[model samples]
Target: MLCKIPDIAKGVISLFASGRLSTEDYREIMQPQIESYRKSTGKTYIYVEADVLLEGWQHQSLAGSGQVQLPNFDALVLVGGPDWFGNAVRLMGPFMQGEVAWYPLEQKALAIQWIAARTDSCN
Candidate 1:
């Protein structure tokens, strides 16, 4: 399932998802949150906490808006997913305009704090 983490500060968008994920989850759910945050802050810190990232049909949706709008984010904190998820994220490094890092799910608080601190430094 895909849903937003509540009460995060403005410019900070955190999503918690696990189990199965689909292209629609990104296109429908995650994309809107990114767009909304971009419109408000012009810069963002995105935190994604997922167990097993992509499942059947989910990989296809990973293609985001190419290089366009890449500068929307300042930092990206990803937590708890399979090794493939980490690799995939690193592969997107050249395309994404944010600093990316990963951590175990148990260190979610640390990941969040890192993004918060990095977001402040980037400003």
Candidate 2:
């Protein structure tokens, strides 16, 4: 499951994730943000805090379904699980089209700082 975090700055969004990921999670919760950015000619800054990876076939589909709006992103900061989760992020980077980064679950401040730095480079 996924949900958008409210009250953050424009062009930047925070999302919390738990349980198995799915295409529906993106379609329902994330696609709207991409559409909104496209209409406004703004780059997307997506920060996701995930509690778990997508399970079963959902994990495989992420490689395909995940990149539908590939160019819509400018920076992606993901915070979750172990330090190796960052490795998982890099492993999955080819399936994405932005700066894909991961931070330990407790280093949210660092994650936010990294995303803020990339905001200046957004197109």
Candidate 3:
């Protein structure tokens, strides 16, 4: 299940995923709040805690035909997850419009702080 991590700084959306994350979870649970915030606020900063995924996004059948609109982030901070996943995200950093950062699960606090600091730059 994906649960929102509360108490995060304003302008930043944080989510914690602990089990299988289905497209339904993203579209039904995650998307609405994200789109709502994006529509209200011009920029978006996202933080995700992905240390405990029973099945990750790569295992999902999400592809071309029914692609959904994703929020354009100002900063994307990912904490925890497999090493390869972290590496892939880091490698894709340059190709992404927003900044991408990865941190170990243990450094979650630092990752949140980093994202919060990034949000401060826009203000």
Tens-place lDDT digits, model 1, residues 1-123: 677777344467888877676656666777888888778767778887877643423444445734223245778878888777777777876677668887777887888788888767755
Candidate 2, after superposition: displacement of residue 19 in Å?
0.5
- Quote each prediction's TM-score: 0.72, 0.74, 0.84
- Scored by CA lDDT, what does every candidate get? 0.71, 0.70, 0.77
In the order shown, what is each candidate's alpha-carbon RMSD? 3.6, 3.4, 2.1
Please identify model 3 stretches exceeding 4 Å from their true place.
58-61
Compose the digit string of candidate 3's lDDT tens values, residues 32-123: 76787688887788888886453564344356645444557788888887676678778888989889998988998899899999889886
| Ranking of all predicted structures according to TM-score, beginning with the best and ending with the worst | 3, 2, 1
Residue range 14-68, candidate 2, lDDT tens digits: 7777766566767777888767765785577888777645332255545754543
| Global lDDT of model 1 | 0.71
TM-score, predicted candidate 3 vs. hidden true structure: 0.84
Looking at model 1, report the run of 10 residues with the lowest lDDT sum: 62-71
Best by TM-score: 3
Candidate 1 vs candidate 3: the lDDT winner is: 3
Candidate 3 residue 76 Cα shift, in angstroms, is 0.6
**CA error at residue 90 for candidate 3, angstroms:** 1.3
Q: Score residue 109 of candidate 2 by CA lDDT.
A: 84
